[model samples]
Target: MVQRFDLAIVGGSFAGLACARSAALRGLKVVVLDAKPDPGARVRTTGIIVKEASDEFDLPAGLMRKVRGVRLYAPDDRALDLSAPGYFFQATDMPGLMHWMADEAARAGATLVYGKKFESGLEYERGVALGDIHAGFLIGADGARSRVAEAFGLGVNRRFLAGLEIECEPLAAVDGRFLHCFADSKLAPGYIAWMVPGVNATQIGLAASRPQRPDLGGLLRRLKAHFDIRDIRVTSRRSGLIPSGGVVHCLGARRVMLVGDAAGMVSPVTGGGIHTALHFGRRAAMLVADHLGDRGIHPVVAMTREAPRYRAKLLLRRLMDLGPPNALINAALMTAPMRRLAQRLYFHSRGEKSESFEAWCKAFEQEPDAKPHLKLLT
Candidate 1:
């Protein structure tokens, strides 16, 4: 007997759970499968989500540790500090966050299954292996290595921004309300190292475009020295890849769509994809809902039509990357306040929220051309 569903979400991480919750809220039947039965999916992420996006998704307030601003330190030790109006929060209590989402989905009539490996072959229609069951629509919220996406031939070619970090006792002087970043050719190249504040400790990590070829020991030592960190007790260490190729197309097939890291939705420079993933995860659910009503799931339609808004932001990020890291930093600091406004205008000028069709049109809007290098903030 084939156990069908309106949506079968693969991987019950942040993206998967968000997708399932959104679908179930609309009274759609959702089945989420994951290989781990643990309440928290993984400890690979620093788990920082911006305040606006967090509020938009209704993530609980208690789960976050508020951060006031950011400090960027150059390799030479020069620092550029910036402060925003609001406080950013860290997703520290991921176990609570994940289980809360799962409970919400279950309450909304979604079925949650754990320890299930998804399989595909000629024996099944959609190639779903659910022990003699099938699904109507499949969503691949799996991480970078997505079997479901491969089964559908939706390829992902991403240049990952490599990162490694150790969680240690909190810095005595470092405020838990700010994130500190270190950049240079020593610890990281083409990427930066970060000190993320946590509840009782700090998560110190460094990332490079070239992950496999890095001096992890030296980087950690430099981090300890630069931050004046002492009496360090290493609690946890993590390393992972954040897709930096911008958003790719062909995320969907006959009855499947990919969201989050599986879709390569990470930012180019910062490599932050939580917001993008959250936004698009809900989008996948809505598309599934539309498909159920015979509206049909338009994979290319969303990518070509609606995805460019994200692509536009990606274009801005790419342009930012075109300049050398130092130059980029200078531009962020030196760009006259008006030009700063123009930077936002030059990139996000189209509108805050772009529709699928309008996004296609805006993709052709070329305002800020790539500069020769990260020269003194022109």
Candidate 2:
């Protein structure tokens, strides 16, 4: 028997779940399909939630660990500390977070179907049909390599960063106060390697431009200089492609739309998309609801006007793809001008004249709800 829904979303991840929840809550009969057996299966990305996302979304606090500073290391091991007083990044328990998000969406009356792959769909005058389900509006929230985009002849991501990561038991020697970042062109060309003290584990990962593979072994070797890694116990590993070419040209059609990584809603330089995915995912639902229910402007047209055009970030991405020499990085990294640039890149001018990082940590620890044990180096 053929089923019917007001909205159908492919890929039950961040964007899909966010859209489904909003659409369903708005009284749309929403159905979300995913190839994975469960919402948390085959997780990708580092799951780092920026300050903006945390402020905007009501994410569960128990599944997140707040990191207040960034320790950027030069190739030669020199480091620069950066922080914005009121801003912090959250390193999440990815699987747990995904499950929570899925539960929230389901609670909002969205039907979630796992282990269902979206191979193809037929678009008619009224809507789109996928296998046994007919939907008034279809949304593709798939990953970087979107089959939906290909099937629908929408713009696809041309540039990408190949990323790999491993989650391991927390290392005692590594400081938990900062997100450790390494800029080594030889090891992670076009991108950076990072160590994040996540909610339950330590996340070590890196991404490199296409055609050049990220060297996890090289990153581990470099990390040995700062911390002992002899008996590290790994928990899980993940890898995926990150879109770095900016937003796709065509975001949607008559009764179909694309959201999240499928639409290239990722930052070309930082390769971050969670914030945009969550923000735009909710917005897409609002627009789609209006168009479908109130005869308002087409969601596609509204989304196209709202999508980000990362022109400046794309330029910076091109420069990063060149993989500047380590010698040049060593010389320029500590310079005053370079420091300013690094600060701008990491903090985005959100930092004001504030107390030292150590002082901030001391004050943060005094907060009644602070996780002091997690903040200290063991």
Cα lDDT, model 2, residue 354:
34
Q: How do the predictions measure up, each by TM-score?
A: 0.79, 0.95
Stretches off by above 4 angstroms in model 2 are 352-355, 362-378
Give a tens-digit lDDT track for model 2, residues 17-77: 9999999999999999999999999989899999899999999999998888898899999
lDDT of 1 by residue, 193-233 (tens): 77877766778777776434345777667766766676778
Highest lDDT: give the candidate number. Answer: 2
Clashes of 2: 0
Report the number of the highest-TM-score candidate.
2
Q: How far is candidate 2 from the true structure (C-alpha RMSD, Å)?
A: 2.2
Candidates' RMSD to native: 10.2, 2.2
Task: Give the TM-score comparing model 1 with the true structure, all chains together.
Answer: 0.79
Clashing pairs for model 2 are none
Which residue window of length 10 is worst by lDDT in model 1?
Answer: 369-378
